[model samples]
Target: MADRNPGMDLDLEWVSGVRVNTQAVLKRAQQVQGRKVAKKEWQAAWLLKAATCIDLTTLSGDDTPSNVHRLCMKAMQPIRYDLLQSMGMHDKDITTAAVCVYPSRVADAVKSLKAANSCIPVASVATGFPAGQTPLKTRLEEVRMAVEDGATEIDIVINRTLALTGQWAGLYEEIRQFREACGDAHMKTILAVGELGTFTNVYKASLVSMMAGSDFIKTSTGKESVNATYPVAIVMVRAIRDYYRKTDHKVGFKPAGGIRTAQEALVWLVLMKVELGDQWLTPHLFRLGASSLLGDIERQIYHYVTGRYPAYHELPMA
Candidate 1:
Protein backbone atom coordinates (compact mmCIF):
# COMPACT_ATOMS: atom_id res chain seq x y z
CA MET A 1 0.00 0.00 0.00
CA ALA A 2 1.12 3.55 -0.76
CA ASP A 3 0.51 6.65 1.34
CA ARG A 4 -1.37 9.65 -0.04
CA ASN A 5 0.02 12.93 1.09
CA PRO A 6 -2.76 15.50 1.44
CA GLY A 7 -0.22 18.24 0.88
CA MET A 8 0.24 17.26 -2.74
CA ASP A 9 -1.18 19.99 -4.95
CA LEU A 10 -1.75 19.38 -8.68
CA ASP A 11 -3.55 21.89 -10.83
CA LEU A 12 -5.34 19.50 -13.13
CA GLU A 13 -7.20 22.38 -14.79
CA TRP A 14 -4.58 22.68 -17.52
CA VAL A 15 -4.81 19.01 -18.44
CA SER A 16 -8.58 19.12 -18.17
CA GLY A 17 -9.00 21.79 -20.81
CA VAL A 18 -6.58 20.19 -23.24
CA ARG A 19 -8.83 17.79 -25.05
CA VAL A 20 -7.18 15.63 -27.70
CA ASN A 21 -9.57 13.81 -29.96
CA THR A 22 -7.40 10.71 -29.81
CA GLN A 23 -9.13 9.26 -32.86
CA ALA A 24 -8.32 12.34 -34.89
CA VAL A 25 -4.73 12.36 -33.68
CA LEU A 26 -4.45 8.71 -34.62
CA LYS A 27 -5.98 9.40 -38.01
CA ARG A 28 -3.56 12.24 -38.65
CA ALA A 29 -0.65 10.09 -37.56
CA GLN A 30 -1.74 7.29 -39.88
CA GLN A 31 -2.13 9.68 -42.83
CA VAL A 32 1.46 10.87 -42.44
CA GLN A 33 2.93 7.43 -41.85
CA GLY A 34 4.45 6.65 -45.26
CA ARG A 35 4.25 10.06 -46.85
CA LYS A 36 7.20 12.38 -47.34
CA VAL A 37 7.67 14.66 -44.35
CA ALA A 38 6.59 18.23 -45.11
CA LYS A 39 9.36 20.75 -45.89
CA LYS A 40 8.81 22.72 -42.68
CA GLU A 41 9.28 19.57 -40.58
CA TRP A 42 12.27 18.27 -42.54
CA GLN A 43 14.85 19.63 -40.09
CA ALA A 44 13.14 17.85 -37.23
CA ALA A 45 12.95 14.77 -39.42
CA TRP A 46 16.66 14.95 -40.16
CA LEU A 47 17.56 15.31 -36.49
CA LEU A 48 15.60 12.14 -35.86
CA LYS A 49 17.43 10.68 -38.84
CA ALA A 50 20.75 11.45 -37.10
CA ALA A 51 19.35 10.18 -33.79
CA THR A 52 18.38 6.94 -35.48
CA CYS A 53 22.09 6.41 -35.93
CA ILE A 54 22.48 6.12 -32.13
CA ASP A 55 22.77 2.68 -30.50
CA LEU A 56 21.96 2.51 -26.77
CA THR A 57 22.59 -1.05 -25.60
CA THR A 58 24.17 -3.10 -22.86
CA LEU A 59 27.54 -4.59 -23.89
CA SER A 60 27.55 -7.36 -21.33
CA GLY A 61 24.60 -9.72 -21.43
CA ASP A 62 24.15 -13.43 -20.82
CA ASP A 63 25.88 -14.20 -24.12
CA THR A 64 29.32 -15.79 -24.32
CA PRO A 65 32.35 -13.49 -24.08
CA SER A 66 33.29 -14.07 -27.72
CA ASN A 67 29.78 -13.17 -28.82
CA VAL A 68 29.75 -10.10 -26.59
CA HIS A 69 33.16 -9.07 -27.96
CA ARG A 70 31.88 -9.46 -31.50
CA LEU A 71 28.82 -7.31 -30.70
CA CYS A 72 30.92 -4.65 -28.97
CA MET A 73 33.44 -4.53 -31.84
CA LYS A 74 30.62 -4.34 -34.35
CA ALA A 75 29.03 -1.48 -32.40
CA MET A 76 32.34 0.41 -32.60
CA GLN A 77 32.96 -0.17 -36.33
CA PRO A 78 32.20 2.78 -38.55
CA ILE A 79 29.87 2.02 -41.43
CA ARG A 80 31.91 4.10 -43.86
CA TYR A 81 34.88 5.21 -41.84
CA ASP A 82 36.46 6.83 -44.90
CA LEU A 83 33.33 8.67 -46.02
CA LEU A 84 32.78 9.94 -42.47
CA GLN A 85 36.31 11.39 -42.73
CA SER A 86 35.32 13.20 -45.91
CA MET A 87 32.21 14.50 -44.16
CA GLY A 88 34.44 15.70 -41.27
CA MET A 89 33.13 13.11 -38.78
CA HIS A 90 36.39 11.12 -38.68
CA ASP A 91 36.49 7.74 -36.92
CA LYS A 92 34.32 9.05 -34.11
CA ASP A 93 31.16 9.73 -36.13
CA ILE A 94 30.24 6.07 -36.37
CA THR A 95 30.37 5.65 -32.60
CA THR A 96 27.08 5.81 -30.69
CA ALA A 97 26.02 8.95 -28.82
CA ALA A 98 26.38 6.85 -25.66
CA VAL A 99 26.69 3.27 -24.57
CA CYS A 100 23.98 2.43 -21.96
CA VAL A 101 24.86 -0.41 -19.62
CA TYR A 102 24.16 -1.84 -16.21
CA PRO A 103 25.80 0.14 -13.38
CA SER A 104 28.42 -2.55 -12.72
CA ARG A 105 29.82 -2.30 -16.26
CA VAL A 106 30.13 1.51 -16.44
CA ALA A 107 33.85 1.48 -15.59
CA ASP A 108 34.77 -0.93 -18.37
CA ALA A 109 32.66 0.88 -20.97
CA VAL A 110 34.18 4.23 -20.00
CA LYS A 111 37.76 2.92 -20.10
CA SER A 112 37.38 1.00 -23.38
CA LEU A 113 35.91 3.94 -25.28
CA LYS A 114 38.02 6.71 -23.73
CA ALA A 115 40.18 7.07 -26.82
CA ALA A 116 37.16 8.00 -28.92
CA ASN A 117 37.06 11.78 -29.46
CA SER A 118 33.41 12.14 -28.67
CA CYS A 119 32.62 12.72 -25.00
CA ILE A 120 30.08 9.91 -25.25
CA PRO A 121 28.49 9.87 -21.81
CA VAL A 122 28.14 6.55 -20.07
CA ALA A 123 24.47 5.98 -19.00
CA SER A 124 23.68 3.53 -16.21
CA VAL A 125 20.43 1.80 -15.27
CA ALA A 126 19.87 2.40 -11.57
CA THR A 127 17.23 2.28 -8.77
CA GLY A 128 16.39 -1.38 -9.36
CA PHE A 129 15.99 -0.79 -13.06
CA PRO A 130 12.92 -2.12 -14.91
CA ALA A 131 11.12 -2.83 -11.62
CA GLY A 132 11.93 -0.06 -9.14
CA GLN A 133 10.25 -2.01 -6.33
CA THR A 134 13.09 -1.81 -3.84
CA PRO A 135 13.31 0.23 -0.64
CA LEU A 136 14.14 3.92 -1.07
CA LYS A 137 17.53 3.60 0.65
CA THR A 138 18.60 0.75 -1.59
CA ARG A 139 17.49 2.64 -4.67
CA LEU A 140 19.40 5.73 -3.61
CA GLU A 141 22.55 3.71 -2.98
CA GLU A 142 22.26 2.18 -6.43
CA VAL A 143 22.08 5.67 -7.93
CA ARG A 144 25.14 6.68 -5.88
CA MET A 145 27.17 3.75 -7.18
CA ALA A 146 26.26 4.62 -10.80
CA VAL A 147 27.39 8.22 -10.32
CA GLU A 148 30.64 7.13 -8.65
CA ASP A 149 31.20 4.61 -11.45
CA GLY A 150 31.27 7.55 -13.91
CA ALA A 151 27.72 7.57 -15.23
CA THR A 152 26.95 10.94 -16.77
CA GLU A 153 23.27 10.05 -16.90
CA ILE A 154 21.28 7.91 -14.50
CA ASP A 155 18.14 6.17 -15.81
CA ILE A 156 15.69 5.33 -13.03
CA VAL A 157 12.48 3.40 -13.38
CA ILE A 158 9.47 5.14 -11.83
CA ASN A 159 7.48 3.36 -9.16
CA ARG A 160 4.72 1.88 -11.27
CA THR A 161 3.15 0.24 -8.24
CA LEU A 162 2.67 3.59 -6.58
CA ALA A 163 1.56 5.37 -9.74
CA LEU A 164 -1.01 2.69 -10.55
CA THR A 165 -2.39 2.70 -7.04
CA GLY A 166 -3.07 6.45 -7.44
CA GLN A 167 -0.39 7.21 -4.93
CA TRP A 168 0.80 10.18 -6.99
CA ALA A 169 2.37 11.82 -3.97
CA GLY A 170 4.38 8.75 -3.14
CA LEU A 171 5.60 8.45 -6.72
CA TYR A 172 6.44 12.15 -6.81
CA GLU A 173 8.49 11.93 -3.63
CA GLU A 174 10.35 8.91 -4.92
CA ILE A 175 11.41 10.81 -8.05
CA ARG A 176 12.32 13.86 -6.02
CA GLN A 177 14.64 11.77 -3.86
CA PHE A 178 16.09 9.96 -6.88
CA ARG A 179 16.80 13.29 -8.56
CA GLU A 180 18.74 14.42 -5.49
CA ALA A 181 20.64 11.15 -5.42
CA CYS A 182 21.70 11.66 -9.04
CA GLY A 183 23.41 14.92 -8.09
CA ASP A 184 24.63 16.57 -11.32
CA ALA A 185 23.89 13.60 -13.56
CA HIS A 186 20.81 14.02 -15.75
CA MET A 187 17.91 11.92 -14.50
CA LYS A 188 15.75 9.98 -16.96
CA THR A 189 12.55 8.60 -15.38
CA ILE A 190 11.17 5.52 -17.05
CA LEU A 191 7.32 5.54 -17.06
CA ALA A 192 7.16 1.99 -18.44
CA VAL A 193 4.38 3.21 -20.73
CA GLY A 194 3.07 -0.26 -21.52
CA GLU A 195 2.43 -1.18 -17.92
CA LEU A 196 0.76 2.13 -17.21
CA GLY A 197 -2.11 0.70 -19.36
CA THR A 198 -3.58 3.72 -21.17
CA PHE A 199 -2.73 6.94 -22.95
CA THR A 200 -4.45 8.90 -20.20
CA ASN A 201 -2.32 7.18 -17.58
CA VAL A 202 0.76 7.77 -19.68
CA TYR A 203 -0.13 11.44 -20.01
CA LYS A 204 -0.73 11.80 -16.29
CA ALA A 205 2.51 10.01 -15.47
CA SER A 206 4.41 12.26 -17.85
CA LEU A 207 2.97 15.31 -16.15
CA VAL A 208 3.77 13.99 -12.69
CA SER A 209 7.33 13.14 -13.68
CA MET A 210 7.99 16.58 -15.20
CA MET A 211 6.51 18.23 -12.15
CA ALA A 212 8.72 16.10 -9.96
CA GLY A 213 11.87 17.44 -11.69
CA SER A 214 12.73 14.79 -14.21
CA ASP A 215 15.29 15.90 -16.78
CA PHE A 216 13.70 13.48 -19.24
CA ILE A 217 10.69 11.14 -19.22
CA LYS A 218 11.34 7.82 -20.93
CA THR A 219 9.08 5.10 -22.34
CA SER A 220 10.29 1.64 -21.34
CA THR A 221 13.26 -0.39 -20.02
CA GLY A 222 13.13 -2.94 -22.87
CA LYS A 223 12.09 -5.51 -20.27
CA GLU A 224 8.31 -5.41 -20.74
CA SER A 225 5.90 -6.93 -23.23
CA VAL A 226 4.64 -3.48 -24.27
CA ASN A 227 7.74 -1.50 -25.14
CA ALA A 228 7.94 1.91 -26.74
CA THR A 229 5.22 2.66 -29.26
CA TYR A 230 4.31 5.68 -31.37
CA PRO A 231 0.95 6.33 -29.72
CA VAL A 232 2.29 6.26 -26.17
CA ALA A 233 5.22 8.46 -27.19
CA ILE A 234 2.80 10.90 -28.75
CA VAL A 235 0.92 11.16 -25.49
CA MET A 236 4.06 11.77 -23.45
CA VAL A 237 5.47 14.35 -25.88
CA ARG A 238 2.20 16.26 -26.06
CA ALA A 239 2.03 16.40 -22.29
CA ILE A 240 5.61 17.67 -22.11
CA ARG A 241 4.93 20.23 -24.84
CA ASP A 242 1.84 21.48 -23.08
CA TYR A 243 3.65 21.65 -19.76
CA TYR A 244 6.47 23.58 -21.39
CA ARG A 245 4.03 26.03 -22.88
CA LYS A 246 2.50 26.67 -19.49
CA THR A 247 5.56 26.70 -17.20
CA ASP A 248 8.34 27.67 -19.62
CA HIS A 249 10.26 24.59 -18.51
CA LYS A 250 11.87 22.26 -21.03
CA VAL A 251 11.91 18.51 -20.61
CA GLY A 252 13.17 15.74 -22.91
CA PHE A 253 11.56 12.54 -24.19
CA LYS A 254 13.19 9.13 -24.73
CA PRO A 255 11.45 6.19 -26.44
CA ALA A 256 13.40 3.13 -25.47
CA GLY A 257 12.89 -0.64 -25.77
CA GLY A 258 11.82 -2.69 -28.81
CA ILE A 259 12.87 0.08 -31.20
CA ARG A 260 15.23 -1.97 -33.37
CA THR A 261 14.73 -1.06 -37.00
CA ALA A 262 15.71 2.03 -39.00
CA GLN A 263 12.13 2.35 -40.13
CA GLU A 264 10.89 2.36 -36.53
CA ALA A 265 13.43 5.03 -35.67
CA LEU A 266 12.30 7.08 -38.66
CA VAL A 267 8.69 6.84 -37.51
CA TRP A 268 9.58 8.14 -34.04
CA LEU A 269 11.60 10.92 -35.62
CA VAL A 270 8.63 11.86 -37.72
CA LEU A 271 6.35 11.88 -34.67
CA MET A 272 8.68 14.19 -32.76
CA LYS A 273 8.99 16.48 -35.73
CA VAL A 274 5.24 16.68 -36.12
CA GLU A 275 4.28 16.91 -32.45
CA LEU A 276 7.07 18.78 -30.67
CA GLY A 277 8.62 20.49 -33.73
CA ASP A 278 12.39 20.85 -34.38
CA GLN A 279 13.47 21.84 -30.90
CA TRP A 280 13.26 18.32 -29.46
CA LEU A 281 15.16 16.47 -32.16
CA THR A 282 18.67 16.51 -30.74
CA PRO A 283 20.27 13.95 -28.40
CA HIS A 284 19.78 16.43 -25.56
CA LEU A 285 16.05 16.79 -26.16
CA PHE A 286 15.27 13.41 -27.68
CA ARG A 287 16.84 9.93 -27.65
CA LEU A 288 16.08 6.49 -28.99
CA GLY A 289 16.53 3.73 -26.40
CA ALA A 290 17.66 0.98 -28.72
CA SER A 291 20.21 -1.81 -28.66
CA SER A 292 20.36 -2.67 -32.37
CA LEU A 293 19.13 0.30 -34.43
CA LEU A 294 22.57 1.88 -34.78
CA GLY A 295 23.89 -0.60 -37.35
CA ASP A 296 20.86 -0.20 -39.59
CA ILE A 297 21.30 3.56 -39.63
CA GLU A 298 24.96 3.03 -40.54
CA ARG A 299 23.84 0.77 -43.35
CA GLN A 300 21.48 3.45 -44.62
CA ILE A 301 24.16 6.11 -44.33
CA TYR A 302 26.58 3.82 -46.15
CA HIS A 303 24.08 3.23 -48.90
CA TYR A 304 23.53 6.96 -49.18
CA VAL A 305 27.27 7.66 -49.34
CA THR A 306 28.71 4.70 -51.27
CA GLY A 307 25.80 3.88 -53.59
CA ARG A 308 26.01 0.25 -52.42
CA TYR A 309 25.56 -1.81 -49.28
CA PRO A 310 28.53 -3.48 -47.61
CA ALA A 311 28.97 -7.22 -48.17
CA TYR A 312 30.07 -8.06 -44.64
CA HIS A 313 27.64 -6.54 -42.19
CA GLU A 314 28.72 -6.88 -38.57
CA LEU A 315 25.99 -5.15 -36.60
CA PRO A 316 22.87 -6.96 -35.36
CA MET A 317 19.26 -5.86 -35.74
CA ALA A 318 17.59 -4.35 -32.67
Candidate 2:
Protein backbone atom coordinates (compact mmCIF):
# COMPACT_ATOMS: atom_id res chain seq x y z
CA MET A 1 0.00 0.00 0.00
CA ALA A 2 1.05 3.61 -0.52
CA ASP A 3 1.98 5.77 2.47
CA ARG A 4 -1.02 6.26 4.75
CA ASN A 5 -2.56 9.75 4.62
CA PRO A 6 -1.98 11.17 8.11
CA GLY A 7 -4.90 13.60 7.99
CA MET A 8 -4.31 17.27 8.51
CA ASP A 9 -6.44 19.85 10.28
CA LEU A 10 -9.63 20.88 8.55
CA ASP A 11 -9.14 23.84 6.18
CA LEU A 12 -12.51 25.54 6.06
CA GLU A 13 -11.26 28.19 3.69
CA TRP A 14 -10.24 25.69 1.05
CA VAL A 15 -13.43 23.73 1.44
CA SER A 16 -15.74 26.76 1.15
CA GLY A 17 -14.00 28.38 -1.82
CA VAL A 18 -14.02 25.32 -4.06
CA ARG A 19 -15.63 25.74 -7.49
CA VAL A 20 -16.04 23.47 -10.52
CA ASN A 21 -16.52 24.58 -14.08
CA THR A 22 -19.14 22.14 -15.26
CA GLN A 23 -18.66 22.88 -18.95
CA ALA A 24 -14.88 22.44 -18.75
CA VAL A 25 -15.14 19.19 -16.79
CA LEU A 26 -17.63 17.81 -19.27
CA LYS A 27 -15.45 18.76 -22.22
CA ARG A 28 -12.39 17.07 -20.74
CA ALA A 29 -14.37 13.94 -19.98
CA GLN A 30 -15.59 13.84 -23.56
CA GLN A 31 -12.03 14.22 -24.80
CA VAL A 32 -10.90 11.35 -22.63
CA GLN A 33 -13.66 9.12 -23.93
CA GLY A 34 -12.88 10.06 -27.53
CA ARG A 35 -9.20 9.18 -27.29
CA LYS A 36 -8.01 6.07 -29.13
CA VAL A 37 -8.03 2.95 -26.97
CA ALA A 38 -5.33 0.32 -27.12
CA LYS A 39 -5.84 -2.72 -29.35
CA LYS A 40 -4.81 -6.40 -29.37
CA GLU A 41 -1.71 -6.96 -27.22
CA TRP A 42 -1.79 -3.58 -25.52
CA GLN A 43 -5.47 -3.90 -24.79
CA ALA A 44 -5.00 -7.37 -23.37
CA ALA A 45 -2.17 -6.21 -21.11
CA TRP A 46 -4.19 -3.24 -19.85
CA LEU A 47 -7.17 -5.46 -19.04
CA LEU A 48 -4.90 -7.71 -17.00
CA LYS A 49 -3.54 -4.74 -15.08
CA ALA A 50 -7.08 -3.58 -14.42
CA ALA A 51 -7.98 -7.02 -13.04
CA THR A 52 -5.18 -6.74 -10.49
CA CYS A 53 -6.49 -3.33 -9.39
CA ILE A 54 -10.01 -4.54 -8.68
CA ASP A 55 -11.55 -4.82 -5.21
CA LEU A 56 -13.58 -7.89 -6.09
CA THR A 57 -16.83 -7.26 -4.23
CA THR A 58 -20.00 -9.06 -3.14
CA LEU A 59 -22.47 -6.86 -1.29
CA SER A 60 -25.94 -8.33 -1.33
CA GLY A 61 -28.72 -9.33 1.01
CA ASP A 62 -28.53 -12.83 -0.43
CA ASP A 63 -24.75 -13.17 -0.15
CA THR A 64 -23.80 -16.54 1.33
CA PRO A 65 -20.58 -18.25 2.33
CA SER A 66 -20.71 -20.42 -0.75
CA ASN A 67 -20.90 -17.38 -3.02
CA VAL A 68 -18.20 -15.55 -1.04
CA HIS A 69 -15.87 -18.51 -1.41
CA ARG A 70 -16.52 -18.58 -5.14
CA LEU A 71 -15.83 -14.83 -5.30
CA CYS A 72 -12.51 -15.30 -3.48
CA MET A 73 -11.52 -18.08 -5.82
CA LYS A 74 -12.28 -15.87 -8.80
CA ALA A 75 -10.25 -13.06 -7.25
CA MET A 76 -7.24 -15.28 -6.71
CA GLN A 77 -7.26 -16.28 -10.35
CA PRO A 78 -9.06 -13.39 -11.98
CA ILE A 79 -8.22 -14.56 -15.48
CA ARG A 80 -8.12 -18.08 -16.83
CA TYR A 81 -4.84 -19.98 -16.52
CA ASP A 82 -4.78 -20.90 -20.21
CA LEU A 83 -5.50 -17.32 -21.19
CA LEU A 84 -2.66 -15.99 -19.04
CA GLN A 85 -0.28 -18.65 -20.33
CA SER A 86 -1.24 -17.88 -23.92
CA MET A 87 -0.43 -14.22 -23.22
CA GLY A 88 2.82 -15.17 -21.47
CA MET A 89 1.49 -13.74 -18.17
CA HIS A 90 0.65 -16.92 -16.24
CA ASP A 91 3.54 -16.61 -13.78
CA LYS A 92 3.07 -12.89 -13.16
CA ASP A 93 1.13 -13.56 -9.91
CA ILE A 94 -1.86 -11.63 -11.17
CA THR A 95 -4.86 -11.44 -8.79
CA THR A 96 -7.45 -8.89 -7.78
CA ALA A 97 -6.04 -6.41 -5.25
CA ALA A 98 -8.48 -7.56 -2.54
CA VAL A 99 -11.85 -9.12 -1.85
CA CYS A 100 -14.55 -6.83 -0.40
CA VAL A 101 -17.64 -8.09 1.44
CA TYR A 102 -20.08 -6.94 4.06
CA PRO A 103 -18.90 -6.48 7.67
CA SER A 104 -20.57 -9.71 8.81
CA ARG A 105 -18.77 -11.64 6.10
CA VAL A 106 -15.29 -10.38 6.96
CA ALA A 107 -14.47 -13.49 8.96
CA ASP A 108 -15.78 -15.73 6.20
CA ALA A 109 -13.63 -14.04 3.57
CA VAL A 110 -10.59 -14.01 5.86
CA LYS A 111 -11.01 -17.70 6.64
CA SER A 112 -11.38 -18.56 2.97
CA LEU A 113 -8.27 -16.58 1.94
CA LYS A 114 -6.27 -18.13 4.79
CA ALA A 115 -7.44 -21.58 3.85
CA ALA A 116 -6.27 -20.91 0.33
CA ASN A 117 -3.03 -19.45 1.72
CA SER A 118 -3.56 -16.21 -0.17
CA CYS A 119 -2.65 -12.85 1.35
CA ILE A 120 -5.16 -10.77 -0.57
CA PRO A 121 -6.58 -8.37 2.00
CA VAL A 122 -10.20 -8.82 3.01
CA ALA A 123 -12.09 -5.49 2.85
CA SER A 124 -15.40 -5.01 4.68
CA VAL A 125 -17.96 -2.30 4.15
CA ALA A 126 -18.77 -0.84 7.52
CA THR A 127 -20.43 2.18 9.20
CA GLY A 128 -23.88 1.48 7.75
CA PHE A 129 -22.57 0.88 4.31
CA PRO A 130 -24.41 2.29 1.26
CA ALA A 131 -26.32 4.53 3.67
CA GLY A 132 -24.62 6.24 6.61
CA GLN A 133 -27.96 6.70 8.35
CA THR A 134 -27.15 4.92 11.57
CA PRO A 135 -26.14 6.71 14.75
CA LEU A 136 -22.47 7.60 15.28
CA LYS A 137 -21.94 5.08 18.03
CA THR A 138 -23.38 2.20 16.02
CA ARG A 139 -21.31 3.15 12.99
CA LEU A 140 -18.03 3.27 14.90
CA GLU A 141 -18.83 -0.01 16.56
CA GLU A 142 -19.43 -1.53 13.16
CA VAL A 143 -15.95 -0.48 12.04
CA ARG A 144 -14.39 -1.97 15.17
CA MET A 145 -16.26 -5.25 14.75
CA ALA A 146 -15.24 -5.59 11.12
CA VAL A 147 -11.60 -5.00 12.07
CA GLU A 148 -11.82 -7.48 14.90
CA ASP A 149 -13.36 -9.97 12.49
CA GLY A 150 -10.08 -9.81 10.56
CA ALA A 151 -10.84 -7.16 8.00
CA THR A 152 -7.57 -5.54 6.94
CA GLU A 153 -9.30 -2.86 4.88
CA ILE A 154 -12.41 -0.91 5.81
CA ASP A 155 -14.63 0.94 3.33
CA ILE A 156 -16.76 3.44 5.22
CA VAL A 157 -19.53 5.68 3.99
CA ILE A 158 -19.78 9.34 4.99
CA ASN A 159 -23.08 10.80 6.13
CA ARG A 160 -24.48 12.61 3.10
CA THR A 161 -26.53 14.91 5.31
CA LEU A 162 -23.38 16.52 6.64
CA ALA A 163 -22.05 17.27 3.18
CA LEU A 164 -25.42 18.44 1.87
CA THR A 165 -26.01 20.79 4.81
CA GLY A 166 -22.62 22.49 4.43
CA GLN A 167 -21.38 21.03 7.70
CA TRP A 168 -17.74 20.75 6.66
CA ALA A 169 -16.30 20.52 10.18
CA GLY A 170 -18.86 17.93 11.20
CA LEU A 171 -18.01 15.81 8.24
CA TYR A 172 -14.29 16.05 9.01
CA GLU A 173 -14.77 15.08 12.65
CA GLU A 174 -16.96 12.12 11.78
CA ILE A 175 -14.48 10.78 9.24
CA ARG A 176 -11.62 11.30 11.72
CA GLN A 177 -13.45 9.13 14.23
CA PHE A 178 -14.03 6.52 11.59
CA ARG A 179 -10.32 6.65 10.76
CA GLU A 180 -9.56 5.99 14.38
CA ALA A 181 -12.08 3.17 14.41
CA CYS A 182 -10.29 1.62 11.48
CA GLY A 183 -7.27 1.03 13.73
CA ASP A 184 -4.58 -0.75 11.67
CA ALA A 185 -6.88 -1.27 8.71
CA HIS A 186 -6.73 1.05 5.72
CA MET A 187 -9.80 3.26 5.37
CA LYS A 188 -11.48 3.93 2.01
CA THR A 189 -13.97 6.79 2.42
CA ILE A 190 -17.01 6.63 0.16
CA LEU A 191 -18.30 10.12 -0.67
CA ALA A 192 -21.50 8.90 -2.39
CA VAL A 193 -20.93 11.65 -4.95
CA GLY A 194 -24.22 10.98 -6.74
CA GLU A 195 -26.08 12.31 -3.73
CA LEU A 196 -23.71 15.23 -3.05
CA GLY A 197 -25.85 17.34 -5.53
CA THR A 198 -22.94 19.20 -7.17
CA PHE A 199 -19.41 18.75 -8.45
CA THR A 200 -18.10 21.33 -5.97
CA ASN A 201 -19.53 19.28 -3.13
CA VAL A 202 -17.79 16.21 -4.46
CA TYR A 203 -14.45 18.05 -4.53
CA LYS A 204 -14.89 19.31 -0.98
CA ALA A 205 -15.88 15.86 0.26
CA SER A 206 -12.79 14.44 -1.41
CA LEU A 207 -10.58 16.96 0.35
CA VAL A 208 -12.33 16.39 3.67
CA SER A 209 -11.94 12.63 3.36
CA MET A 210 -8.23 12.99 2.71
CA MET A 211 -7.90 15.44 5.59
CA ALA A 212 -9.48 12.82 7.85
CA GLY A 213 -6.84 10.26 6.86
CA SER A 214 -8.69 8.15 4.28
CA ASP A 215 -6.18 5.83 2.62
CA PHE A 216 -8.45 5.96 -0.43
CA ILE A 217 -11.36 8.23 -1.38
CA LYS A 218 -13.97 6.30 -3.34
CA THR A 219 -16.62 7.63 -5.71
CA SER A 220 -19.71 5.60 -4.86
CA THR A 221 -21.16 2.79 -2.77
CA GLY A 222 -22.13 0.82 -5.90
CA LYS A 223 -25.70 1.49 -4.82
CA GLU A 224 -26.15 5.02 -6.10
CA SER A 225 -28.33 6.21 -8.95
CA VAL A 226 -25.18 7.69 -10.42
CA ASN A 227 -21.99 5.74 -9.97
CA ALA A 228 -18.47 6.55 -11.15
CA THR A 229 -18.52 9.05 -14.01
CA TYR A 230 -15.64 10.72 -15.79
CA PRO A 231 -16.64 14.26 -14.86
CA VAL A 232 -17.02 13.42 -11.17
CA ALA A 233 -13.82 11.35 -11.23
CA ILE A 234 -11.94 14.21 -12.89
CA VAL A 235 -12.87 16.47 -10.00
CA MET A 236 -11.94 13.93 -7.30
CA VAL A 237 -8.60 13.06 -8.87
CA ARG A 238 -7.79 16.76 -9.21
CA ALA A 239 -8.46 17.16 -5.49
CA ILE A 240 -6.01 14.30 -4.88
CA ARG A 241 -3.44 16.08 -7.05
CA ASP A 242 -3.95 19.42 -5.28
CA TYR A 243 -3.80 17.82 -1.84
CA TYR A 244 -0.54 16.14 -2.73
CA ARG A 245 0.80 19.46 -3.95
CA LYS A 246 -0.02 21.20 -0.67
CA THR A 247 0.80 18.50 1.88
CA ASP A 248 3.39 16.43 0.00
CA HIS A 249 1.20 13.42 0.79
CA LYS A 250 -0.31 10.96 -1.67
CA VAL A 251 -3.82 9.58 -1.20
CA GLY A 252 -5.52 6.90 -3.30
CA PHE A 253 -8.65 6.97 -5.51
CA LYS A 254 -11.23 4.25 -6.18
CA PRO A 255 -14.06 4.67 -8.72
CA ALA A 256 -16.74 2.15 -7.92
CA GLY A 257 -20.14 1.12 -9.31
CA GLY A 258 -21.47 0.81 -12.85
CA ILE A 259 -18.01 0.09 -14.23
CA ARG A 260 -18.99 -3.22 -15.88
CA THR A 261 -17.04 -3.11 -19.10
CA ALA A 262 -13.36 -3.73 -19.81
CA GLN A 263 -13.29 -0.57 -21.92
CA GLU A 264 -14.63 1.42 -19.01
CA ALA A 265 -11.91 -0.05 -16.80
CA LEU A 266 -9.28 1.05 -19.35
CA VAL A 267 -10.75 4.53 -19.43
CA TRP A 268 -10.38 4.81 -15.65
CA LEU A 269 -6.83 3.46 -15.85
CA VAL A 270 -6.07 6.04 -18.53
CA LEU A 271 -7.58 8.76 -16.38
CA MET A 272 -5.35 7.76 -13.46
CA LYS A 273 -2.25 7.58 -15.61
CA VAL A 274 -3.02 10.98 -17.10
CA GLU A 275 -4.21 12.74 -13.94
CA LEU A 276 -2.13 11.19 -11.13
CA GLY A 277 0.72 9.62 -13.13
CA ASP A 278 1.77 5.97 -13.14
CA GLN A 279 2.15 5.76 -9.36
CA TRP A 280 -1.63 5.81 -8.84
CA LEU A 281 -2.02 2.98 -11.33
CA THR A 282 -0.90 0.47 -8.73
CA PRO A 283 -3.37 -1.47 -6.54
CA HIS A 284 -2.14 0.40 -3.43
CA LEU A 285 -2.99 3.79 -4.91
CA PHE A 286 -6.00 2.93 -7.11
CA ARG A 287 -8.82 0.38 -6.95
CA LEU A 288 -11.87 -0.40 -9.05
CA GLY A 289 -14.77 -1.36 -6.79
CA ALA A 290 -16.62 -3.72 -9.08
CA SER A 291 -18.39 -7.08 -9.28
CA SER A 292 -19.26 -8.07 -12.87
CA LEU A 293 -16.36 -5.98 -14.22
CA LEU A 294 -13.91 -8.84 -13.89
CA GLY A 295 -16.08 -11.16 -15.95
CA ASP A 296 -16.17 -8.75 -18.87
CA ILE A 297 -12.42 -8.14 -18.62
CA GLU A 298 -11.73 -11.87 -18.72
CA ARG A 299 -14.01 -12.24 -21.71
CA GLN A 300 -12.09 -9.51 -23.49
CA ILE A 301 -8.83 -11.32 -22.77
CA TYR A 302 -10.32 -14.57 -24.03
CA HIS A 303 -11.28 -12.92 -27.30
CA TYR A 304 -7.81 -11.46 -27.64
CA VAL A 305 -6.21 -14.86 -27.22
CA THR A 306 -8.38 -17.25 -29.23
CA GLY A 307 -9.48 -14.80 -31.96
CA ARG A 308 -13.12 -15.33 -30.94
CA TYR A 309 -15.42 -14.45 -28.14
CA PRO A 310 -16.19 -17.31 -25.78
CA ALA A 311 -19.70 -18.51 -25.13
CA TYR A 312 -21.42 -17.33 -21.96
CA HIS A 313 -20.43 -20.52 -20.16
CA GLU A 314 -16.88 -20.62 -21.48
CA LEU A 315 -15.34 -18.42 -18.74
CA PRO A 316 -16.12 -18.88 -15.07
CA MET A 317 -18.52 -16.31 -13.64
CA ALA A 318 -17.09 -13.81 -11.15
Runs in model 2 lying further than 4 Å from the true structure:
none
Highest-lDDT candidate: 2
Model 1: per-residue Cα lDDT at residue 279: 78
Q: Which residue pairs in candidate 2 collide?
A: none
What tens-digit string does per-residue lDDT give for candidate 2 at 1-318?
787899999999999899999999999899888888899899998999999999999999999999999999999999999999988999999999999999988889999999999999999999998899999999999999999999999999999999999999999999999999999999999999999999999999999999989999999999999989999999999999999999999999999999999999999999999889998889999999999999999999999999999999899989
TM-score of each: 0.83, 0.99
Supply candidate 2's per-residue lDDT for 73. 94
Instruction: Give the alpha-carbon lDDT of every model.
Output: 0.71, 0.95
What TM value does model 1 have? 0.83
| Model 2 worst lDDT run, 10 consecutive residues | 31-40
Using TM-score as the measure, the top candidate is 2
lDDT at position 195, candidate 1: 94
